[model samples]
Target: MGREFIDLFDKWATSYDAAVTGHDPQYRDVFENYDTILSEVVSNSEGNVLEFGVGTGNLSKKLLDADHHVIGIEPSKAMREAASAKYPDLTVLDGDFLSFPKLDIPIFTIVSTYAFHHLTDDEKGKAIKAFNEILPVNGKVVFADTVFESEETKQEIIDQAKDNGYNDLVYDLTTEYYPMKNTLQSLFKQNGFYVTFKQMNKFAWLIVAEKQ
Candidate 1:
């Protein structure tokens, strides 16, 4: 959670989009669910949104296409540049989720995908609390990422990923601090968020947490 993290993304930014979107057919379902949930939330929400780990801005592009006001925060300069080039109208800042500067806006929704996993469990709770403080009543956090039922389930996913020719993804998953779905729900609820969850597939899920 330092320069190493930023450096990794900077190095991969050029190929990150294809590496993710074209990883495998199974990953297609992940993006579909992310877009579906994001579209549903954006359509229902009342104010603007702040997206963390905007990466190449695929999700923000969709949000912009739908006419939702969005500001993106990305720690990687290369990724931010790519996103900026793709959407010159977009506002992309340089910062990570745990360390982003506060924005002055009526943010009704916060969205992130596969980015929060960089934080440890305690940090995840802190991140959620920060979201609560920033959002007013009824604000929502739409989080979509890799989740598991248990350690065994996580290991199973790793095995399957390696078998499916996504060895790099498997390695990252194994090394990263991916949280269990139930644990994540508890963290959300503990931080004054009423939560709803939808499992997109075995390895991915979406959490919609409304501020109380």
Candidate 2:
């Protein structure tokens, strides 16, 4: 399922930036909030940062502006192409998060947004383990994604979408990808990271984990 989704996204890459940029303002706000979260975690001396899913370079551009040396790994070829075109200087690699190329240099911080929830539970575990293996003892990982809200809230959101004329388009497309917050946190905890920061909002949660 994950591989199939990746392939589909690769096909959608050509229009992804336009599609997402025009998406509901809430979606864009998620990424903006991520930048705020990162500001709290990244220090002046923090070295190389790895972004697991550098989709279209939206987040990458912000990180680059922060003066961090950013390396991005993106699985979709089309997405990588889009990112390369936008930020030619970014080190974007075509690879899956589970099998990302191991860098000889130690990582300072690992970050991903929206993309991590696409992984199945087992894959999420493997991803956490991989991050642990690559990060130094005190390194941090910050991630955020849409999470499953209560049935009432979820239905309300769906109903709102229907009223907004997005029912047939966006709602159905995103329903399948919603994840549960506890489930994601457990995966990280099982892999030896401590969840230090967690903020749950309407339909998403942001988490910051530090290596113990």
Candidate 3:
């Protein structure tokens, strides 16, 4: 799954919150309206929630605060520990998008933020298919992450990041699993979902894919 990025996430555990809070200029735009975005994800989700990539549990806290029964799955041990430290009661499992402990309870909604890009397009398709199997009819997948309009537009953003000397950001854009709008639309539909996209920032889009 996304374990290939675990070392980076382990190293980033202490700084991840700061980075998302705009302390890192390289990622400022990517994390624009960070608080509002989390709130939007929380608002869009309902019932028992399974949150993949619960890095530092920021979004999990929001879900819990909203009185939702939430279960989080994270691959990085360090990230999982950090999230546990932040919220002792929350249960964050060791897993990724494609592989995780099977949940027994009925899950009505799945929510993730800024983390799904760890999986490639093929992996993403598999994840969506798995969601179809796990969720009830009309169940939703609410994710807010970086996505591009097209390959050309993605290249433009990467070029800008390079010009600004944000080499890490460039590397992330080039290496991570950020997908195009059409690609995601097709993935959701092929797996029996009705999807919608709302641009949340220059780099991020809110994707709501409901199981059909």
Candidate 4:
């Protein structure tokens, strides 16, 4: 479903690693504490993770390092190739959140980072519903992404980016489907999850949604 952005991701595959490592000044805040954020996601994750939008497999690498079995789904071929090159044994497949290869095994947790913003709120709801269908009770969804406190906060951040002359960041903030915290809480509750958010950095929040 997020395949529309594949070309951008394919183009970003080579440089994405550098950007996340704080080499790109414009996105520094967006990816603030990159390694720590990935580590937090890995720590919060449970057994058998289904990671959507596994760009470059940063989180996947950490999960494997922690000895967690991970299945990664990504929409970009170049990104898949990049991760595969990094971890030749990791199973990264071509897919998106809403429609990935069906898993034969049960998933204890779903983990993703910086990628869920690609989905609109409605699409996110549908994806969560799909996740609910697969996961047993008490299973969790641990995601670390750019989640704002409110619409005002979102707009203020965008305006600040504009004042900094970060036109590219502004464009990304405007184009992507990032959601507010309260809205996500309500959405998760409606779909039978008790979700909590922990601020990881200026932009990203670590969300743990336990299926109830």
Candidate 2: tens digits of C-alpha lDDT, residues 1-212: 25546766686677656555546553443334544544544432256788888888877787787788888888888888888998899999877778777676678888776677677777778888988988888788877666654556656676666666764335443545565666767877888888844554454466788888
Model 3's TM-score against the true structure: 0.98
The lDDT per prediction is 0.78, 0.69, 0.92, 0.90
The weakest ten consecutive residues by lDDT in model 1 span 26-35
Best by lDDT: 3
Sort by lDDT, best first: 3, 4, 1, 2
User: 138-194, model 4: which lDDT tens digit per residue?
Assistant: 999999899999899999999999999999899889998899898788889989999
Q: Backbone clash tally for model 1?
A: 0
The true-versus-predicted C-alpha distance at residue 62 of model 1, in Å, is 1.3
Question: In model 2, how many backbone clashes occur?
Answer: 0
Q: Which stretches of candidate 3 lie over 4 Å from their true place?
A: none
Q: Would you list the rank order by TM-score, best first?
A: 3, 4, 1, 2
| Model 1 TM-score on a 0 to 1 scale | 0.88
By TM-score, the better pick of 1 and 2 is 1
Q: Highest TM-score, which number?
A: 3
Off by over 4 Å in 2: 19-45, 149-156, 162-177, 197-201
User: What is the alpha-carbon RMSD of candidate 4 to the true structure?
Assistant: 0.9
Task: Please provide TM-scores, in order, for all candidate models, with all chains considered together.
Answer: 0.88, 0.80, 0.98, 0.97
